[model samples]
Target: MSLSVVICCYTAARRVQLIRGVQSALEQAGDRDEILVVVDHNDALLADLRDSLPHQITLITNEFQRGLSGARNTGVARSRGDVVVFVDDDAVLATGALDGARAAFEDPTVVAIGGAVRAEWAVGSGPSWFPEEFGWVIGCDYRGLPACGERIRNPIGAAMAARRQALVEIEGFSTELGRVGDLLAGCEETLMGVQLQSRFPGQRIIRHTDFRVDHHVPADRATLRYFTRRCYQEGRSKAVLTRISGRQAALSSERSYTTSVLPSGAWRARRNPRRLLALVIGFGYTTAGYVTGLLLSTRSAAAA
Candidate 1:
């Protein structure tokens, strides 16, 4: 299957990372593959990239809403490949990543595929207090994901792909649920996976460990404050997803993560006071956010 990589960017602050991401995609693209750089309503960044990027790369401004989901939707619409892969602007595709995705899609039963996202910290390694189980807060592959090739409820947004038809059937990513400007809200991918499964019953969404990407984790995201805020936002996103897609479908993976994965992680971190404390604090914040979001959503429904 021909691949179309959609790298979305919204700011000039990540100009360096975005360029590297595009370059990585370009290097790994097959003869039939294409790379599209979607700038989320940023005119200045669009103009700058147009001049700096290679001619083969297609750079365009987001013609939909002003956020990550909209930018991704715009890319999906413009792309011509059989598989539309979404790569974050701050992430670099590993060698053969596109090939891996195409190979997996050879199975007609698969509709979506996601790969590992290794963290490339801005400082030495990463914060010692950061727990591995909560790596999703930084868009990295966390501890407790299935061994690979196993089915997943959803693919992480930073490095995921969907069959073009599957995406078109679902009408692309929902604009309601993703990062808008500075808001950390997300779960667009989660909703997409649910929609895909509903639309094509029996189809699979699996993770391919070989199809990997290295995501740049800036210093700002390494802080405790950012960690808490991100965890809370994740909870809020999950609540929104549950409201839209029903709780059973929305929180299936989360239930397992909470009951099985987290307990194991906590036990492993018991020897490290800092990691153990971080895990506990992160869980508390996420739970608080989920409750707050659920209450707000319920109130809004009644008010409506």
Candidate 2:
């Protein structure tokens, strides 16, 4: 299947990482594949990319709302590939990642595919106090994911691919729930996965460990404050998603992660007080955010 790799950027701060990500896609893209760089309402960044990025990449400013989801929707609208793959501006695709996505789509039963995302921390490695269970807070694949390729509820947004038809069928990612500027809200991809499965029953969203991307984790995200804030934001995003898609669809994976994965992780980290404490704190922050978000959503519904 032809793949269209979409790399979206919003700031000049990640100019180097964005360039590297585009170059990586250019290198690994197949003959039938195409690369698109969507700049989310950043005129200066768009101009810079136009001058520096290779001519092979199709560059365009986001024509939709001002967030990752809208930028992605813009890319999908302009793309011509069978599979639309999303690569974060701060991430580099591993060799053969696109190939793996193409191979997986060979099975008509699969509608979406996500790969492993390894962290490339700015200070060499994550802080010693950071627990692996909360890696999602930093936008990297965490410890709770299945060890091998399998059908999954959803794919991480940092590096995931979906059938263009399925995306079109679902009308693309929602503008309601995703990062708007520096806001930590997310779960646009999760909602998309639920919509895809619901619209096309029996189709699969597979997680392929072999197809991977190295996501850059900036130093700012390595702090304790950022960790707690992100966890809380994640909970808020989940609550918003649950309101839109219903709890069962929005939180099936979270149920397993909270009940089985987290408890297991906490138990395994018993010997390491720091790690255990981090996990506990992260869970608490997330839970608090979810509760607050739920109340807000309920109030909004009543007001409506």
- Who wins the lDDT comparison? 1
Give lDDT per model, in order.
0.92, 0.91
* Model 2 bad stretches (over 4 Å): none
TM-score, candidate number 1:
0.98
**C-alpha TM-scores of all predictions:** 0.98, 0.98
lDDT of 1 by residue, 1-304 (tens): 8999999999999999998999888888889999999999889998999999999999988999999999999999999999999999999989988888889999999999989899999986889889999999999999998878999988999899999978988899999899998798889999999999899988999999788999999999999999999999989998999889999998999998999999999999999999999999999999888889999999999999
User: For model 2, where is the 10-residue window of minimal lDDT?
Assistant: 144-153
lDDT of 1: 0.92
Question: In candidate 2, what are the lDDT values of residues 1-304, reduced to their tens digit?
Answer: 8999999899999999998998899989888999999999999988888999998999999999999999999999999999999999999989888887788889889899888999999999999889988889988999978765688888889999999988998999999999998999999999998999999998889898667899999999999899999999999998999899999998899889999999999898899998899999999999898999999999999999
Kindly provide the TM-score of model 2 when superposed on the true structure, using C-alpha atoms: 0.98
Weakest ten-residue segment in model 1 by summed lDDT:
93-102
